[model samples]
Target: MEKLTAIIPVFNEQDTIERAIVSVLFADEILIVDSFSTDLTLSIAEKYDVKIIQRDYEYSASQKNWAIPQASNNWILILDADEVIGSSLREEIQSILNKKSTKTGYWIYRNNHFMNQAIKYSGWQNDKVVRLFQRDLCRYEDKRVHAEIITSGDLGFLNSKIDHFTYKSLRQYVEKLNRYAALQAIDYDKITDKITAYHLLLKPLWRFLKHFIIQKGYKDGVAGTVICFLQAYAVVMRYANLYLLRKKN
Candidate 1:
């Protein structure tokens, strides 16, 4: 029988970490990569029979890249703290590992939820990530935000979807966007010639329209409207932060 290792990268996810761990218990080994959390996260994680490794905070790609080689099994399942694997998905993963062929990685689609409601649209309907892969055949692309895995061999798609509880509150969502914006600002500064009104105003408008109207976010009603606005706000913050970074330097 082929064994699989589940790697969960977390930081201060005290509320959701336990649930995440419980969902992946089917795996032969569970590895928790902590970002030196100053909360009950570690204490809660200690309750489980899992191997824990603490490392300093960095971007997502770098953190996962560092932890990939540490997994005990040749196959790795990367899971986020707020994600839960349902029975169907769990069974599907197990079935694949038991008789996998030449595929190096698998793309898993996420069923994103916001404020406890499953979002059906808002440009998030197609959200997916490559979480299951061969340890030696895959690595994350070097990116500060929204990095994808670069696989050395052929990739396959999974039929089962993950339940991703994205954000519980407005404050939490805003804080997350702020953090992402700060990271994105560094990349924006390198490519942007000048911070203009178009970047601060028009780009955000387009983002909102693209999501809310073009992407059929209106179908999701209130959640869709809010998400689209937040997406636009994120764009504004990215450029604003970039402008500030340039001014400082």
Candidate 2:
């Protein structure tokens, strides 16, 4: 059989590390790249029989790029610590590897849950990401926030969904917004001229409107509302932080 390896990047994810690692045991090798987590994340991962690679914290793209070459197998399945693979998804992945995959990488539709609610209207539908790929054909860009895998060949989507327990509570959502905003600010700082008032204000409102109305956040009720609001707030913070960075420079 052609070798398939699962690669996961983690940071202080003690709550979900074990499940994440177990989900990929079907692979020839399971490799986890750690960012010096100050929790039981390392210990939990160790119990799962995965090869652990330690490195300092960095952006998502950088971390994933660093992990790709470390994989022992030619094919790699990249998964985040918070994501879980259902049996259907696992079987789908195996099927793809068994034959010639249509594309250099496979994009999986992600299903994210917020506060125990499956938020349908929060603009997260058919959230496709190219995580499973031939190790030599793909790498992620260096964007600090909203990083995505870069692939040269055609893209194909997996029918099964990768479950993402993205937010356990409103607080977690807020914290992520703040963290991502800071990263985006730093990421955009290099472009100095990109910071503008519209991004700081109008764009955020528009984002909220897009999510709450265009994307139909109303169906998810409170969780959808919160998700849209947090997205808008993240937009505001990104520009605000960028503006400050520009002022300092």
Q: Which one wins on lDDT?
A: 1
Candidate number of the best TM-score:
1
Candidate 2 lDDT, tens digit per residue, 87-179? 999999888888876688888889998888776668998577888888888888889887877878777888999999897567776887888
**Model 1, 32-71: lDDT tens per residue?**
9999998999899889999999889789999999999999
**Clash count list over all predictions:** 0, 0
Worst 10 residues of 2 by lDDT: 188-197
Stretches of candidate 2 exceeding 4 Å from the true structure = 190-196
